[model samples]
Target chain A: MTSWQIIILASIAVFALKLAGYLVPPSLLERPRPARIANLMTVALLAALIVVQTLGAGTRIVFDARVPALIVAAGLLAVRAPFIVVVAAAATTAALIRLLT
Target chain B: MSTARSSQHKAAIRASVAVGIAVSAYGISFGALAVTAGLDIVQTCVLSLLMFSGGSQFAVIGILASGGTAAGVAAIASSTLLGTRNALYAIRMAPVVGGRWPRTLLAAHWTIDESTAVSAAQTTPEGQRAGFWWTGAIIYLGWNLATLIGALIGNLLGDVSQYGLDAAAAAAFLGLIWPRLKSMQPIAVAVGAAVVAALLTPALPPGLPVLAAALVAVVVGLTNWLGPKDPLPAMQQLDLGEDGFP
Candidate 1:
């Protein structure tokens, strides 16, 4: 399928998912187990995304500029730096590493 | 309206607008990175408009950038999985946005993190409505405009890696989810998932590792359910007062 088709289908799916939330019985959502999983899903998926983006390159895990940049980002985040600062710091760290090397 | 009530409403508006502008700064990066990641200007804008969720859009683009063989499928799956949280958000927002189907549908379209956070922060239903609509409108406008500007700039400055825009995707993702790691359980879950994905990258396909990592959450969730009762973690509390900025 083409990119546009993929986007269109995904758009419909997303809207359906959002709308389903309103339709689902509150009893299901209020359950402790599903709620717990839903909460952790964000953290887990994001972590997986970060790991893949930073370390993976076409099925090979390699260390590169993103590793240090991510370290800087994690540190800034640990300190509760503003969102903009975290992005700028990470980008600058990666850019400077690339420049120096 | 009374002066005090008017002041409170004004404060909610100011807060919502501030969140909108702050969120838009990330949109500029998303726009530029999406183009660099092989999406056209129109595709990027449409993704932002329809998918309408930053994390999911970034996930899709990130998969594409990583050279996934089935990039489209991977993108959609990851995006769909990441978007499930919006359903949870909608559950919390349903009571607050009670109206006819048309209004509720519009509210559902706007049921994103920032809008939900701002609306949940309000004390009154009116203020909640104000917060939700204003944040949604400003973010929609600001995000699309920034996306256009960034895409134009990115298209002009081809080969975005020279400026380290390549790493911007990961950086942006980190910036987004970092604030939510307020407690140990979430941190542990993130660490565990990262480890699982890192280990699985060599053996599995591009997207499967991410999907596989979700099992860790499922296991944890199930264990929590079967085990003795424990206090709710910060993440599960859904306290908007501490949600901070978008």
Candidate 2:
């Protein structure tokens, strides 16, 4: 499938999951395992994404400007900076690091 | 509507608009990142409009940007896995979004973290519904609009890597994950999964590492090995055996 097809397919699949929840038996909610696992997977997957996007270039893992940028991002987040600030700071930090080194 | 309901509606609208604007402003980052991830402006906008789930949309673009579709269906799998939380959200939101057919369908689309959170914060049933509807509407509009704006800006800024948009993508993920890292188990999930995925990245294919690392989370989560020592009350624990797989 093309990129468009892939994106659309994903959208439909996710929407279907959401719609199914409304239609399905609420008894599923009684079982906390599935929901908890889902939550846990979200956390895990996101953390993994951070690692991949920061360190991986294609299949090769290269430590570069992104590491300090990510550290800055984490620091900004720790200080309760707004979302946009955190993101922009990360980008700027990386750009500056690359420019200098 | 009674005076109380009307007041509740007013309050919900106020709260929703505030959060909606703040969160939607961040959509620009997503838009910029998605386009940097190889999606066109149209594709980026369509994604936010349709998927409307921040984490899942990021997953889609993140995968696409790195290895293209050559990653072998990992994009869809990871994106859908993230969207699974919306299904769980819908369970809590069904009654708040109570209705039939088209209305319910729309509610499902809006059954996301922000709207659910706004609704859950309310004390009254009316307030909950009002919060859900208001937050969903504002966020839907603001998020899509901001996505368009970001996509346009991203298009103008060629060669995104020099601008560090790649790092911005990772930072975006960190931003999303930050709030959830409150407990030992979740912290363990993040640290373990990150290290494992990092370790596996060199050996495995582009996307496989992340997927494989998710197993670590499943193991840690299922075992509850690092979770709080305080047990669930007996009634809740009745079903969970020693293995704690369930």
Candidate 3:
């Protein structure tokens, strides 16, 4: 299929998945196991995304300035720094590293 | 609304606006990148409007940018995988938003990470609804506007990497997730997922690694459910309320 077709189909699928979540029985969602998994899934997925975004470029995983930038972001987060500060600090760290090297 | 509730709503709105703007900053890059990746301005906007998921939209553009032969399939697969988390968000949000079809349909479109997080952070049901709607509206507006601006600017914003906007998404995600890591279980889960994704990066496809790492949560949840009745102090401390972290 073309990109247009793909986008349309994918949108439908995404909407369906979301609607299914609402349609699910409360009993199923209230179950301890599923609830716990859903709770932790966001954290897991976010962490995974962070790693992939930092390390991977297309299919190639490379250690670039983003590694240090991520470390800086994590440090700022550990200290409970403001969100803007953490983002700016991390971005600056990466920019400076790239500039110097 | 009472004075207290009104203040809470104001605070939620304020926070959501700030996050909306920050998240929209990334949208500028996405718009420019999508165009650079050979998509027309209309197509780029359509992705932002219809797909509406930043990570998945980026995945499609990134695959196209790489000029892969199977870019279509790869983009769809990668984007679909990243979009699954919205379903999880929906499950958590269903009870709070309730079952009105028209409203729920709109809610489904906005059932993204930012709205979900902002809503989940509230202490009241009204606040939850307010948070979700406000955040979703702001993000939708901000993201689309930024996309238009970025697309109009086009390649003028050359080499987004030099400015470190490339890492902006990851940094933003880190900031969002950091506040939620209240105890050991979550921290462990985050670390385990990150490690798994990093390790699998070289072996698996781009988005599949993240999905594979999600299995870690499933495994842990299953273990906690089926295994011996060892009480986890940290898990017990989790506030399983509509207002609490999910």
Residue pairs with clashing backbones, model 3: none
| Native-to-model Cα distance after best TM-score fit, residue B153 in candidate 2, in Å | 0.6
Query: What is the C-alpha local distance difference test score of each model?
Result: 0.78, 0.83, 0.71
Q: Candidate 1 or 3, higher TM-score? A: 1
The ten-residue window of minimal lDDT in model 1 chain B covers B234-243
Listed in order, each prediction's TM-score against the native is 0.92, 0.93, 0.72
**Candidate 3 on A2-44: residue-level lDDT in tens?**
7677667667766776777787765554455655665567677
Candidate 1 per-residue lDDT, tens place, B1-246, comes to: 687777777877998888899887777777888888888999888988887877777887887778633667877877787778788778877877757999888888878888888887888777887888898889888888888887777787788556676666777788767776777777888888999999999998887888888888778767763333665643345654533433
lDDT of 3 at B102: 96
Candidate 1 ranges with C-alpha deviation above 4 Å: B1-4, B225-228, B231-236, B240-246
- Which scores higher on lDDT, 1 or 2? 2
Candidate order by TM-score, decreasing, is 2, 1, 3
List the lowest-lDDT window of 10 residues for candidate 2 chain A. Answer: A29-38
TM-score of chain A of each: 0.89, 0.96, 0.74
Cα lDDT tens digits for candidate 3, B1-246: 599999888878887777677677667766765766567788888888987877667666655544333456655665665566677678778888856789989888888778887877888887888888888899899889988887776556456578675565567667656765776777888899999988987887666677788887777767763333654432232333221211
